[model samples]
Target chain A: MFPSRFDLVVAQTVAEAVEAKVDAGEGGRFLAGGQSLIPMMKMRVAFPETLIDINRIAGLDAIERSNGHLQVGALVRHADVVASDATFGAVAAAAPWVADPLVRNRGTMCGSVAHCDPEGDWNSVLLATGAEVIAQGPSGERSISIADFVDGAFTSTLGEDELVVGLRIPVPSGRSGGAYLKLERKIGDYATVAVASHLELDDSGAIAAAGLALTSVNPINTKVADAEALLVGQQPSEELFAEAAELAAAAAEPRDDVRGTAAWKRQVVRTYTKRGLAAAAQQAEGS
Target chain B: MEVNITINGSEHASDVEPRTLLVDHIRRTVGLTGTHVGCDTTSCGACTVLMDGTPVKACTVLAAQADGSEVTTVEGLKGADGLHPIQSAFTDDHGLQCGFCTPGMMLVGASLIAENPDPSDDEVRWAISGNLCRCTGYINIVKAIQTAAARVAESSNGS
Candidate 1:
């Protein structure tokens, strides 16, 4: 039912994909997994004159570790992340909770982040993991922290001519634990509200560092630094969790939509925040 | 645009519009209708197929995007003598009532079994979570996979 005309060009490399997009000019889009782009195209929300298929690009589907960081290629599928023994403990624990297995198999990690959907499951996790996004343009490659990479809802600092090449996640040190919790209205719908928490403990088993991010409650996934601050140096306790949850809820300015009301979202944020922090605390204890 | 893709281990070249979805290309040009399109959006896994050995929703993938890639549809699951073990298990275990979601279920199931020959009920559930089924309530589908896994293990041991 959607009508549009476009040329398809399969690019075998990142340079070729970029060149194709530049040559196509203002009306070109890169086709990765097409999990997000194709549906948007069918809905007529996004119409591009040319589609540069980047699936055949080599080295874009690998996941490896280097320099105390985990590097995931832009084209790595969510399923790949979920299945990998190296990254699966973190990614698998969260991936199956995404839309579904089919989408996970085709949806690329970079595509999800680049799409910058406010309710995306992985965005906040990426932020909580202290990941960096690598983008390649005509000039060269430049890396930006996830916090600086995403600007707002459905938007990023990425230039039109630039494409995301890969993501770099700093390896967690010491005793650290991370977890993602999302509240969805249905099985396949976007998260109405989500929380990602990372806690690192010192040798004394006291909280040394904490990272927390909330999604679907605002125009962008935001880290609740104040809440993280509330946990540092404190033992993981119900009272501390309640305090962090309260602070996190205060930080979020949720919207009222068909899925939920602002008040309900606030309640959920508070509830999920506590739960997520508690889980992160337990994970940190094990680490 | 003219795109060539290998479907079920055979390469087929066709002249298709850039807008043609891989699902449509397989159903129309390649004459394989086992893959069904359940939803316009990629939310449903009714059109699930193995693209380069990964189970993906064919509806979301454009035919042009699938160029030079190998795809496996449900119709390709059969062996020389009979149906694939999973297919026979689905039949013997009464995995389908309406059978609309059967192809996608089988494709996703085959992909799962291929990866993990012995999958737990939860693993099977997780594997086919993307493929939705209104009939059979997924109980028998899970049973079918369990049966297939046992059969596959038995055959492998026998051989």
Candidate 2:
């Protein structure tokens, strides 16, 4: 199926891309990986009048660790992340689970997060890690927290003329670990229920910081704030994790779909959250 | 807009619409039908091609997106000899039944072997997990890839 016709501007720089967006005036969309936008266009669900192609823009593909944050550029593909040495915490764990190998070759991490699909995996990882979205607009560059950046399903607080330049995921200063637990029907399928868990331990082996987020079981990538609150200051144990898992499952708003009944999915959420937290704790201890 | 794409080592420059897909460009404009289109929604790997030495779903990539990149399609998998090692391995091991998904599978296998000369069975399975085959169950396909890896290794060692 061919997409509806649109004018294409191959932006050579970020400034040019922003300018093009301003000219298109709400009808322009930046084409990063085109993995998500192209498919939506083919289905005629999205028909932007102008597309600012950012593939030619330079300096937007770096995956570097600097200033105590792992900065993933907008052009950083999922395959790049899996092969990079700079990833950590939930970012590294979830990179390989973003999609199948083929799709991962062309899909970008920032684009996936910008698409704001509740089923997308990277947002959950970013939410769980308390990452920031680096956005460049006509005014200037700014950093927005992941929690505030994601407005809803398939939506973000990013302005119309702004383009996401990168994602800043803070590097854990202490003993920390993370795991992305996903339940998919197949390799290329979206998660029926996925959990992203990150844990930091203090000197006394108590939970210092905790982040828990659920995917495919909520209106948006739901950060389990209540569950995270329960994890902090507590010693990692089966009982503690079980209570946190129960709270996480209670936060899910899964709908009955072909994957399974809503009740079954919520149960899966509970089980995965518990299991993911255990894996995180184990990794943290090992580290 | 004009896109100058290097396909199979030859430059095929053409003016295409902004919405034209890379798969359509390769199949229709370049006339290399070896790359089949299946489930154009990026679910199937029948449209897989090596864009700049990485396997990407062509149907999901716009022709304009691949403007300056080097693309290697199924038609490009050939050595100085009659057939590439992976192609011969597929023939020797009865890797294909209907051959609809053969091109995509071969491209992915060729890519996997290039990166890893001696991949384990699980690696081969994981490499081609994106490609789906309705027939032949996939045992023979995996065998073909492993056999190809061995043959390629033997040839390189002997040389």
Candidate 3:
């Protein structure tokens, strides 16, 4: 199916893009990798009267480490995140399971976050890492925490005039690492359930700082705060991990969809969170 | 919208809608139809093409977004007098059955070799995960990629 009629504006800067969007009114969209948007548009699930092409904007595709954080520009594709230098290690671990090579080559990390699909793999990891989203608008730029950026599935806290410019993630300060574990029905399919785990070990090999999140289990805001709280000051052991994983599963409020039943997803969340936590703990131990 | 795209090492100018997918432009405007569209969504690699030397789903990329960028389609993989080594490997290894997924497999296979000349069987499988082939059980597909990698390495070494 073809998309509805729309005009195009090539934006060389953020201001121009925002202005174009404002002029185009509520049906305006910022076209990035188009991996997610175009497909929806084709199916008539989404329609924009105008598209502000942000690909021409310079300085929006750089990945850098600065001021104790890793800064990923809005145009940084998943392939770039995988191949480029790591600001945080876990985003790369999740890259392999994000669609496939072709989609990875074109899909932008910021785009995925902006789409805010509850089933997206990046949200769990980004939320787990407490990644900050940077957006620019007529009123100037502002940063939204990943926790606050996503309001629900396909919804965000973004102002209609704002465009995501980059994402900032804190660099682990100690013996720390992260991992993204996903359960997909097929080799290339949306995850049934995914977990992102970040752990930092103290001098005694106990969990110092930990972050945990879940995706595809619905509610779009599936943070295991208690699960994370459970790991801190706790010894690294399979029994403890299982307890936290069970808590994470219990907290999930997923709906039954084509992916899986709510019960099945909860079980997956329980299992994968443990696996993700274990993987992160191992990496932290190695470091 | 007007687009001046550089595809297959040649620059061509055309008028396209802002909604025109790169795959359609490559097929309708430039008339290079080897790039198949198995899934209009980004799920299938049947529409894969190298945009600035990186494999991307052509069906998801807008022609306007691809303007001023270099693209290498399956048609561009042939040598002056014969099929590319990867294509030949497909024939020898029986990598294809229905042949619908061949172009994408060959193109992505070339990219895999370029990125990792001696990719392991697992690596080859992972690289083509975006593409789906219902024929040959993918055993020969993996073998074909391995064979192509060897031939490509041999040719480069000889050169």
Q: What does candidate 1's lDDT look like per residue over B1-159, in tens digits?
A: 888999999999999999898999999899999999898798778888899888888889888888889999998899898999999999999999999899998888888888788999999987887778887469999999989988998999999
Which candidate number has the best lDDT? 2
Count clashing residue pairs per candidate: 0, 0, 0
Measured with DockQ on alpha carbons, how good is candidate 2?
Answer: 0.89
Q: Stretches of candidate 3 above 4 Å error? A: none
lDDT of 2 by residue, A133-244 (tens): 9999999999999999999999999999999999999999999999999999989899999999999999999999999999999889999999999999999999999999
Order the candidates by TM-score, highest first: 2, 3, 1
Ranked by lDDT from best down, the candidates are: 2, 3, 1
User: If candidate 3 were superposed on the true structure by all CA atoms, what would the RMSD be?
Assistant: 1.5
Q: What digit string (tens of lDDT, one per residue) describes model 1 on residues A121-144? A: 887888777789999998889998
Better of 1 and 2 by lDDT: 2
Provide per-model DockQ scores: 0.68, 0.89, 0.78
Share of reference contacts found in each model = 0.81, 0.89, 0.81
DockQ of 3: 0.78
Real interface contacts reproduced by model 3, as a fraction: 0.81
lDDT (Cα, tens digit) per residue for candidate 3, span A1-287: 55777888999998999999888889899999888899998888889999888998999889888888989998998888888776565776887788778888888999999999998888888888889999998889999999899898899999999999999988888899789988888876888888889988889988888899988876685778998898899988999999999899888877788887998889888888888888888888888
Fraction of true contacts reproduced, model 1? 0.81
